[model samples]
Target chain A: MRGYTSDKDGYLTRLRRIEGQIRGPQRMVENDEYCIDVLTQIAAATKALQSVSLGLMDEHLKHCVAEAIAVGGDTADAKVREASEAIARLVRS
Target chain B: MRGYTSDKDGYLTRLRRIEGQIRGPQRMVENDEYCIDVLTQIAAATKALQSVSLGLMDEHLKHCVAEAIAVGGDTADAKVREASEAIARLVRS
Candidate 1:
């Protein structure tokens, strides 16, 4: 979270792999795999997605929001509000 | 993407399910499953995470950034820069 950009390559690498992962379940379902088997794959995908979300949130909080606050005043307020709204959106999502 | 807040619940629901998904692979690994089988599950998880990332980015673009720009001036400039940096970070990730 310190330098969100620093780990960009890693995150993208993981995301690219996940793009492949999404396709796996589809092929399984198309092949008429067992319900439980399909569900398990779906579950796995969902979990991986959550990790990305959490990571992104941390980056936003630790870097973006923190920087904005350092500047202080309206920009800081805006950044804080923006982060709160985003967090709310993420939580609700 | 039109109204990020509107779909917040849906996003969260998917994410919550993903949390469960993450655990599935762990159990599989612990069970000493075949390498291929474990990989497939991992693939599925990665795909799901990507979908969420895309959705979040879309929401940020269509809703959050849009609102900040509408306000205009320094806040608008700040929001736009923040978003561009975020997109850059995300792409790298």
Candidate 2:
């Protein structure tokens, strides 16, 4: 999350928009909109959120993980494990 | 994100906390804290975000997808595909 701080605002903005995207689908459902249309919107919103997660993961690797591995030790090992687990959780979700 | 609006505040609160958690690691990195420590914090933050995604997914299944399937048709097929792809993306992440 090194560069994350610098880009935090951008990320937050996108996530906020994503929240709206998600809300759009819910509203559609409430209005008894076509199920297919609602589902498609939900899919789009979900993908948008996933992109944020991917962006964070990229920054994490480029900064944190790389630095840890460079200064190899228990810390390095732990960083690797932490990242893998994070990826696993994302996949499982 | 059906019930998501009803519980939006709670979800937003948790996401904000996770944002702080991520910020913590960035600060740690800036301060040259141990790499393991920073990575661990990132892991926690990542997991927290994943939980949010899972909660959304669960609500989606129980509400949107369930309703679509109940009114089976092209919408049902689309809804199932949409959800499966979402799970796939999560797994790929």
lDDT of 1 by residue, A27-55 (tens): 55455443233334544555655566566
> Model 2, A8-92: lDDT tens per residue?
6666566557656655744564554543454455456556655666777777788888888999999999988888887875555
Using Cα atoms, each model's DockQ against the true complex is 0.03, 0.10
**iRMSD (Å) of candidate 2?**
7.1
In model 1, how large is the Cα lDDT of residue A23? 61
Q: Using lDDT as the measure, which candidate wins?
A: 2
lDDT of candidates 1 onward, in order: 0.56, 0.63
Model 2, C-alpha of A81: deviation from truth (Å): 11
